[model samples]
Structure formats: C-alpha cells, structure tokens
Target chain A: MSTGGGEAEFEAALREAFERRGREAPAAAGLLEAVLARRRRQTRHRVAGAAVATALVAAGTLLGAQLLRGGEPAGPAAGVPAPGIFAAEEIELCLLPGGGDPAEVLLSAEVGGEEVQTAISEPAGDAFRLHVERAPGYTVRLDVLRGSVAGEPLDGARDVRAGDRPGRIGDAPGGGRVLLLETGTEGVLLRLTAEGTGPGDAELLAWAAKITVSTGRDACES
Target chain B: MEFDDYVLTRGDALLRFAHVLCNDAQRAEDLVQEALVRCHRRWRRIEHGGLDAYVRKAILRQYLSWRRRRSAEEGPAGDLPCAGGAPDQGIEAIGERDAMWRLLAGLPRRQRAVLVLRYYEDLPDAEIAGLLNCSAATVRVHAARGLARLRRHPELTGRAEVVEDA
Candidate 1:
C-alpha cells in the first residue's frame, strides 16, 4: 500500500475497532434496578439523618436552657456515657468498588484514649478491621462493614447508644462481645469486637463512643 | 419521557458509549450508572429534550475526573476483541492494527478522549471541546498530539514499509 493508502488504512482500522468494541459492550441488565436501589438507600439515610439532627438540636436546647437557669446539670446517666470525655479520633475508610465488599483503609489512628496503645487497620473481605490493643491480652477489634450487618444474629442483640449513633450489642461467637454501631455514612456499620476476657460492656461502649468511622469522600465519591 | 422508559430505551446506547470512552466493561457500567442516577433525580426538568446529551456529558466528565484506584504501575485492561476482518487481511495489516490499538490505549486520558470523540463519535473540535470543558484549540492540540504519537510508532511505520516492498 502507498504511504497515503497506509495512513488511510490505519485510520479505518481504528474506527472499525471502536465500532466493534462499542458493539461488544455488555447488556446493561439490572442497571435500573441498581440505580433505584441506591436511590432508595440514600433517601432512607437522609430521613434518618434528619431525625437524628432534630433530636440532637432539641436535646441541646433543653440542656442549654437548664444550664443558663443556674440549675445543676444532670450527672452522667446510666448506659449513656458523657460525650466528648474520651479523645475520639475520626478514621476515614474508603470503600472499594462492587458494593465496597473489600474496603481500602484510607486512614487509621489511636482510638479511645491513651489507654489504648495503637490501632492497626487491615482490609478484610467485606469488612475493614481496626485492631486496638488495650493491653497485652486485651485487644479491641472493630470491623467496619458497608451496606449490611455482620453474620451475627440480631435476635437477642441489645440496643446500645453511642453518642447520637444507635447500634446493637451482642455476644460474638467463639467467646467475645460484639458491638455493631451504625456509621453515619449510608449503609456502613462498625462491628466492634472485644476479644479476650479483658474488656466488658463498659470498655466496649467507651471505645465505641471514642471511635468515629467516616467513609472517605475521594476514590469512590463519584 | 418517563425515567423508566428512557432508561429502558437508551440505556444500552449509553453503555456502549461509556465502554468506548473508558475501554473497561466494569468501569463503563459504573460510569453509566452514576450518570443515570444523577439524571434520574432531575429527569422531570430535562425529560423534554437534550436528556441524552446531558447524560453523555455527565459520563464524559466522570470518566475524565475518575481517580483510578489501581496503582500507577498497572495499565488499563487489554484491548477489546478483534472487530472483524480488515481489508488487506494480511499478517502485517493485523500486526499494525493491534499495535495501533495498544498505542491508542497508552495515550493520556484527555488525548485518548479527544481522538475517540473526534473519530469514533465523529464530533467536530468545538463540540468535543464543549463536552470536555476545554477550548477548541486545546481539543485540536490533544487530537494532533495523539495522532502524531500513533503515526510515529515503529511497528506501524515498519509494517507499512514491509507492505510497500511487497
């Protein structure tokens, strides 16, 4: 082929390749279903978030009024620990694609207070595990799962509250306590597992209160 | 048009366009899904006309700004399967086409996008610039650079020389 002819042939090949690839695109089956499902989830989250915000505002207003009136503020209520007592660190975990089945750890830090030594974050299938070693034998493991609860049953799970977040506390199989808290992000939950006999409900609740989970707004944001 | 009807009718075409833009099946689906989700929210306002154009623009913008999770060392997935038979149907012709496809894959995202829009979509430079949110001059520059890179490949040039000798 002449040079001009060769160039023309190359262009034709490129165009033809694009056309073929376009034809080879897979059927967009379940696309509408997926979009609708996502929209529903987002709507649910927005409603729940609005409710929580309204409740917080009301409670804050009541407490402020009492304090301004010179009335003694109520002591720490049982089960509901005082907020901001523990130095909480917000850890942002970026969820992987495909429903974030296997999330990537964007950040990790010392959770709870100085009593907790260090936090080790690892990507577990369908869950992001954050291991906090309180002492030699006492380790607190928190697994963040996106979009669903862990395999543990919620039948006998007790309702627990950490700050404004509501969750369920249950006994983990194989001898441990598990606290599942709903991370503010839609469909993301933090499964706090207390392995070893060292920490009980009090310690677990404290740790849960101190640690905050945030879905990072970068990689999967779009 | 109703959202469901629109999706059922044009969803396949959007998927194909996204596939051409991103060159990855999974990523293409994601791009289309995201664009549809955004459009679904405002379908009431845009349903009368230009809805297809709106969704296509959304897909293109997302593809351009997408931060790939994979490490930089990894390249895009391999090229799509062979389209069909070429005119010459010779070994050299096949080699050149394959080499050109790989070179196209390696171009910078913007340049690749420019070439795809100009050639595959048969868009003018101004239209492509409007989609890409850049000036027509910039679109021309990207297309020129991309075509120049493809033309300079040794495999294409050498294979052309071989075909000429024959």
Candidate 2:
C-alpha cells in the first residue's frame, strides 16, 4: 500500500480508539476545590515570606537610625578602643582631698579653645573615677604639686625613667597604675582608671609629662 | 463567566480530550485537574481570553511534560484493560479498538500525541504545532512516522499495508 493510504487507515484506527474512550468521562467532582485550595496555600506562603522579609528590613533600618542618633560612634577605629567606652562623662575640676587647698594647677588645659578648670582631688578611688569623668576613655590623672609630699612609700612601686626624670611606677588603690615623678621643686603623679583596658604605663607617663602647663594663675583661684 | 460555572460546563469535554491524549483514565483526570487548577490560579488574567482554549493548551502542555516525571514514566502498552461502559458494539469491535490502542501506545508519546490531535481532535497541522509548541513541519513528520509505525502492527493491519480509498 502507498504511504497516503497507510496514513488515512492508521488515522481512522486512532480515531476509533479515542471514540471508545469518549463514552466515559471522569466526573469533575472536587477538582475545582482542590485547585483553589492549592492556589490559596501558595498565596499564603508568598505573603508570609514577603511579610517576614519586610519586617526584617524595617527592624534593621530602625536599629541603624537609633545607633546613628546616639552620640557614640558606630564602631572602633583600627588599633583603638570603642569610642563609647573612652568618651568623657563629666568635665570638671580635679579638686584636692581636703577641698581647702587645690592641687596647684600649674596650667589649665584648653579642650575647645576655652580653658577647662583643672584641680586635683583624691576621692575614694571609686568616686575619684566617677567624678573626674572626662571623655569615654581611661582618665589620665595628672597632679603637679608645688613640692614633694612626705608620705609613706607607695606599695608595688617600681623605679622607672620617665623621660629624663627618674620616676616610680606604682599600682593605685583602684584598677590602674600611677607614675610618681619628682623633678626637684615640683612633683607629678599620673594615674589612669577605666572599666576596661587602658593605655600602657609608658604612654600614660609620657602623656602626663606633656601636659602643656602654663605658669598662669589657677582659674579656680580667680 | 465565573470559574465554577465554566468548569462545571466544559470540564467533562476537557476530561475526554485528556483521555484521548493519554489513554489512562486516572492520568487523564490528573492532567485535567492540574490544568484547571493552573487556570483557576490565573483566572483574572485568563478570564478575558477564551478560557476553553487556554485550558486546552494547558492540558496539552501537562500531558506533554508528564512523561519527564519519574512517577509518570509508566509503560502505556502494559495496562490495556478495556474502559468501563462500552457501547452496544460487539466484542469483535472492542477487540479491534483495544488492538488499535496497543498499536498507538507503542509509538513514541510525541508522535502518538500528534496522531491524537490530528485524527481525534481534527486539528490542522499548524494548530497542532501551536498546541505541541513545535513547527508545522515537525508535526507532519511526527504524524507520518506514527502512521508508518501503526501500519506495521501485524495483528491490527493483518500484515498488509493500509490503502486509502480512492
């Protein structure tokens, strides 16, 4: 037989087979309900995922705004402690123990072009730290007295050369160390106290020595 | 028209069409159900167009792609039971129809789909190509190859080539 006849005859047979099937069709039954339920489930998942993502993004934005608004810097700079820890809490005079005589403020330091009153006070160690709050870092306590005090030798004091001046490094009553420097007529004591880490003794001593002291009258005296 | 009304009316015909595409009654039900579910999900967008044609295309796609699923890789030739509710046609006619079904099932699924679309559905070559997502030439080739294979079935064609009536 020719290809054309084969095509027509096979086609006829296929049609007959389908006609046999056309007699019985399955019921629609619950097909629509099943499909609609599937659609609803997909919609719920999509909406829930979108909602969670949106909530996360909004929370992140709010947290970022709050951090920016707070005076503390976002993160610590390289090799530096976090700024919030080191920032000064209060800037006031470091008064003496009796309050009758202030530690002779050799020269007041200028913070923002205004001379900030500087006095030396020996409070109970904890109060000393709380009252003498500077920026958020270790407080660099510098005391330059008019003359050396005749007191018992400080405990745990070790001899060290701070620049040309021979000084003794001793642990303070609180959690930091102090450097005692006697330069003939005037004596300087440097101490640093903070909640966390502080600068090395050599660094603090150097910082204490470099206090740009002016031989002017004390601001508290005026 | 509402989706419920449309399905209620046209669902039976679509099921029959799916049965012709895939001989298994259960598979046909699944195919039609999946297609209608997809249509319902996108009803707002597809409601403006002819929903019947859209659903027919979806059913054709589902049938075509069904073979790829490992679960759907069933041997169509093995399960050749006669469908329920046969017409008053004699047993000889039923045997001939079953013979035709086995012959048709032995062919490649794409070629069988081409035959079903062309002969059973009375679709033109171009229309079948659109439903199959192929070129008209490809449809014709599949049809020719499928018919050639069907003629080779010894029991159905009596070991003789089928001849077209002039």
Candidate 3:
C-alpha cells in the first residue's frame, strides 16, 4: 500500500460512487403527492381535535357552574379576580387520550382587576405544569395531570369523566392554596395552586370553577 | 421556487448525500424522506437559497440522532472490520471505492460528516459551519481529525500515495 496515489484515488473513488448512486436514485414520482396528502390529513385531524376539545370545555364549564350552585361564593371585595383557566394551545402528536397529539395547554386569568398574561407549562409525565409570575419573586402554578384508558373503561369516574367535579379548596404544603378538581374526564385532574401574594382560596376555587380547555391542534399529527 | 420544483431538482442529490453519510441505502432513503417531510412542512418559512442547505442539515441531523440498534445477540468486538491492512493491489476500482467507504465509516459520526461535506459536497468551511450550526473552527477541527484518521487507517497503510492530509 503506497501513500503516493491515495488522495487521487480517494477523490476519484468518491466521484465514481456519487455518479453510480445518482444513476440508481428514485425519481420524485409520487413523493410530492404523498407529502401533500399528509399535510391535508394533518389539517383535518387538527380541526377535529379542536372541535372535541371545545365540546369538552363547554361541558366542563356547565359542571363547574353546577358545583358552585351549592356553595356560598365569596365576593371579589376591592378587586375582581380572574378565573383559573387552563387552555390547551397546540396538541403534540400522539400524546392525547385518544392517541392524537399532546395539546399545548396554558393557564391564564385576571387577578385583582389586572389582566395577567397567558403562560405555557412544561410537560411532566402525564401532566402539564405551569408556573405564573404574580409579583417580584412571587409566583403561582397549575398542574393539569391526565390519565385515560381504552377498551376496559373505568365508567364515568374513570376514562370519560368530564372536567368539572369539585373537590375542596384547601391548604397545600408550603403555604400555597390548592384546589383539586376531578375534571369531567375520568382520568384528568386539575391541581391549581397559588402562593406568596397570589390568588387566595376563594379566588382559586372560583378560577378552578372557570377552567377552560382550548385545543391548539398540531399540524404534524400522523 | 415552488416546493415541488425544489424536491424534483434536489431529491436525488439529497438521497445520495444521505447514502454517503450512513453507508446504507435503506437508512439513507429513510433519512432523506424524513428530512423532506420536515422541509415541506416549513416550506413557506424557509428563505430563498436556504432549502438545500436546510434539507442537508436535516438529513445529517437525523443520521446522527438515530439510535444504534445493534443487538446484544450479534457478535461482539471481533465483528468489526480490520483496521490495519495495506490497500490490496489486485482489487479493482470498485473495490478501492468500497475500501474508501469502509475507512470513512470507521470515523466518528461528526468527523465523517465533516469529511463528506468537505470532499463530496465540496462545501467551504464557513458554509459547512453554517449547515452544521457550528463555528468554522470546529468544522476545521473535525476535518483535520477525520483526515488524520484516514491516513492512519490500516487499509491505506501501504498505499504508496495517500490523499493530501486535511
């Protein structure tokens, strides 16, 4: 083996290989049509998912209204507080209960007459976690954890429970207010917590009562 | 240009580029197809003169990100091709080409990519850097190390003439 012709040989060999491969490469053929078809299907799926999420949100709102009917609601006193609303933005592909994309959900509401901007959450296991900045060095968060099963369904309390069953607005560890809501869906739970000069127990409960689900359907769903 | 036009002109070249990077036709096809799908999705957002570079970058990224699927059931360390051998004199051009492919495959993924982009794509360091999302200095480092590894390959050991060192 000599080093003398190695460079020439390597370059020549690469060129030859490229030419040979070009001769065997497939034509564009049906590729364009296939891509277009995929895009169309994704659009349809997104539209359908959004519709489903909207229906769920409406049902959940009804349930929240019913739950609040029995309790003595607190007045907003000096300022009107915003409801805790968890709205799904874009659902990621293959992360939903029905084998669709995971929804990009957010939590937003007004606190004390000021409109708090929206905030997105980080995905954690079967939950989406959101942290909202209330003031300098003070914050609050909402964790929406989901669970579902197919075929051997768990009745209304299991797979298909709507998103509005009320539990209790109680003390959470670390001095935060926690509202546990059994979402109308069987396996979904919305845990809303407010800490440091954030929403109070009554406000958090009201927010939980007004939780909404909006779907941002993913355009890349398979 | 329209997305379809871009695909018609650049699809085969992207496939060939993938083949060189992965050294397997099926894997190359899959990588190129995945990249094309992604490019199609973001077609409107991509700038002019950017699609080819974007697709190339996507293919390389997919190739590098693929998980190694070699099973434990396969033969262990002894299964690797020999690292030390003089380039066989009796072998024809096709054999030499294969020899080169083997040597190229032996390098680490990034080094192999740098060498292929440099020699096969004939891309300049700055451009290759842009495609790889790395600095030009890093590209040079990869190219230098890759060429050094090729020079040290056992197959090229006895070759009277070696390619110029990077």
lDDT of 3 by residue, A87-114 (tens): 3322121113334434544443423222
TM-score of chain A in every predicted structure: 0.47, 0.37, 0.39
Q: Rank the candidates by TM-score, best first.
A: 1, 3, 2
**lDDT tens digits by residue: candidate 1, B26-49:** 677767776676677677777467
What is the descending DockQ order? 1, 2, 3
Give the residue spans of candidate 2 off by over 4 A.
Answer: A1-9, A38-222, B47-49, B66-88, B159-166
Better of 1 and 3 by lDDT: 1
Whole-model Cα lDDT per candidate? 0.61, 0.55, 0.55
TM-score of 1: 0.50
DockQ of each: 0.17, 0.16, 0.13
- Which 10 successive residues of model 3 chain A have the least lDDT summed? A151-160
Better of 2 and 3 by DockQ: 2
Best of the candidates, DockQ: 1
TM-score for candidate 3 (chain B): 0.78
lDDT of 1 at B113: 87
Rank the models by lDDT, top first. 1, 3, 2
For model 3, give the interface RMSD: 12.3
How do the residues B47-85 of candidate 3 rate in per-residue lDDT, one tens digit apiece? 867778887987776666412222111111112122222
| Lowest lDDT 10-residue stretch of candidate 2 chain A | A82-91
What is the DockQ score, from 0 to 1, of model 1? 0.17
Using Cα atoms with residue i matched to residue i, what is each candidate's TM-score against the true structure? 0.50, 0.48, 0.50
